[model samples]
Target: MNTLFGSNLKYDLKASLVVFLVALPLCLGIAIASGAPPMSGLIAGIVGGIVVGALSGSNVSVSGPAAGLTVIVLDSINSMGTFPLFLATLVIAGLIQLALGIAKAGVIGYYFPHAVIKGMLTAIGLILILKQIPHALGYDVDLMGDQAFLQTDNHNTFSEIWYAIQYYSIGAIPIVLVAMGILILFERPKIKNHKILGVVPGALWAVLSGIIINLAYGVWKPEWQLGGDHLVNIPVLDNLGQIGNLLTFPDFSMIGESTFWIVAATIAIIGSLETLLSIDAADKLDPHKRTTPPSKELVAQGIGNSISGLIGGLPVTAVIVRSSANVASGAKTKMSAVLHGVLLMILVLSIPTILNLIPLSCLAAVLFLVGYKLAKPSIFISIYKNGWDQFIPFIVTVVAILFTDLLVGIGIGMVFGLFFVIKTNFVRSVTLTEMNGNYLLKLQKDVSFLNKALLMKNLSRIPSGSKVIINAQKAQFIDHDIQEVLNDFIASCSDKNISITVEGFKYKIHENI
Candidate 1:
């Protein structure tokens, strides 16, 4: 246990706490945004943290209700009108994921082009910048903040921006500009090198700016609520007893509707893609050069979703935001995730009041950092250096994801990459080995015109005096290039008295004495 647990579980606990701090607000925000009962997010987190953590093979992935699933969840809820029916679909989605895992379909992740991933991160980052502006400027019109482009204040993203602009709070705008300036200036290495700020994360500084602005708003415009659309408004509880009231069961009678299945399918596919993509990224970040068991993750997610459905929660996956937080916090094991869940439960139950102190703007700042990590310039440079083959799909994937939805873009990019690889491998001849360490160039399949280059390259590698066997016992056809090479090589072999065996293919011997 110690070998796996490490010497200081302290780091894990600390990391877990950091992640929990981040997860708590997101859970509620996502739940509300998905149009589900606010309690659903917390339930998913509890299940993801407690149940999935124990069962997962992933060392660092933190499971939760992801923003990606909001569209599916909300759609399901709308169509079904009953949460229980939605729950049934969640169960089905889980089963499908489990089967994918068991079938070792984890390779599906590798097919995504790197460009698409880069594009995705960049797009999400751009969306983050747009969404956070309202919160940074203290607009509180609707909680439709960050990446989910559907606006609650208005239907379109542009309208949401317009709404924020029209009601732009002077108190909030100045604060945002000041904080943004500080963020940009501090990010410069020359300024950061002074150690005056002493290794403060951009998010911490941003959050600090938010608190200061929040307090200033209290004094300058106390009568007017400056933050119109960006505040996180989870209902605060005074005591531990309030947690019991946190859960909200979905109405199950809507199960008969076809929309429930459509929603369920949406959740499963998108969730799986998101999870797989995250798994690939997390593996790349691992110091141990480990490949996470994607299939196991699918099973774990299946179980998580099943449980979430039964207990009235949203779908679960290995969310990149929380996983990145786990990495940033120096987590070394899944224990960090498990403990984070426990901490979430405790805090929600015992100190719900403490959570109210954190402002929504502060959380948006953290998300800003996350979006940046996913879309950094270095990621772009690295993918380009990997050569055109890797670069193309990656680019396509990103472009598709940005313009279209997540899964569609990745699918298009992967198709291109697959064709490129297969077309490169079809022009080859076969080689059979003899027991005596020599090699036989054997022709089995049809010696199509494509085999000429391979035949030439191979014929050039043969030593001056080495014995060779040419066997074509099963071949029905031999192209001219192959036959010519074999016929030409016999002269040198006879001159050197080199042993040669030609089986199944008739050849005339030439005497040159």
Candidate 2:
């Protein structure tokens, strides 16, 4: 057990420190955007790291409050009336996720086509880049990690960019440019491969550079100084008891509302889906190529969300941004994730003031790097080469997600993918062969119910008075609708004087002549 984590202590600690640094600003920003107490995001981050990290089967994936669900969460909090009442809905959502895991609903995760998943990730990448521009310019009106097209302040994603350009802080410009330069230099192979220097993540240095630049500005160019609004805003705590004082408990009184269940189910399904997709993406990113058990991941997320909600936190999911950061930072085990969580708890409890000193622009610069990695233009070229069947859905998903929300975009992409599936199946569901005068009909692969009309038409084309042969040996599953059509055709075979022979059918032909 110790070997699973302790074996890579040096590497894990370094990686965890990077992830912790990345998470701190996001936790507070998401909470502010969601209309919940800033501490709620921190709570969710802690639970996601320590609780979900320990319980999850994933080695590289990191869990926390996701920007993908920010719109839904904010709407829920507003519509639900109170933060405690919203917490109740979150608890219910966790319970629903637990039931889904037990029911093996995780299998649904595998059904998402690779094209769609890639599209979703790519869309998120684009959103991150666009949304963070305002923060990077030190506008700081829109909270960090708010991925939706529309902002909490009524400004849409693109409008935020224009607004930031028009109203950006002159003082923030130099800090962001310097931080971004440091980050870009860190990406160089020479620097990245160095033993001692490579050990340090660019994000860490970028943050430090931002702080120092701000300090220098404050000292010399006092007129161009950034205020507290431009920096991280974690609540200051004087003692351990103050932490509990900030915690908000769930209001169980709202359990009887029908609307409560609807909200719960929504969070559960979306959170579970997001977690599953993030796990899949993280596994692909892992250098070791380890696979995570989907069912166990769902169970872990359920437990984490439940605890997070009970103590006032947003719904948690396996966040691709942090997971990708963890992998890029050289995390070896779940221990890194746990350590990040512990550090988050410790920082918020002990040194929140120090954290508050970190600039939002620095975090935005780090996310810009993360976003670039996910949505590199080469990815689009590769997907496009895969042909329209793959590229159409991929492009459609990216566009839909940009205009709408994550789930809606995914649904759009899946629908296009399903159309392709049905089209391909319609063409090959039934195969034909002729032996002398006998006509043979063979069902290939798993014939879907979508092929019923085509199958019936093909069967009708079989000349009357000709012997017919039906083969189901290669079929893994014959849809019940197709089976009924076959049964009806077989029952009328005698009248047409077309004698029929059947092979490899598991079920008896009903009303056989």
TM-score of each: 0.72, 0.87
**Global Cα lDDT for candidate 2:** 0.86
- Candidate 1 residue runs with Cα over 4 Å from true position: 1-10, 103-107, 110-126, 139-167, 173-209, 220-228, 250-266, 423-513
Best by TM-score: 2
TM-score of 2: 0.87
lDDT of 1 by residue, 114-217 (tens): 45555555555555656666665556555632345555543555566677677766566655565556656755767554555624444456656766767766
Candidate 2: Cα lDDT at 149: 81
Q: Can you give the lDDT of residue 314 in candidate 1?
A: 87
lDDT of 1: 0.69
Best-fitting candidate, scored by lDDT: 2
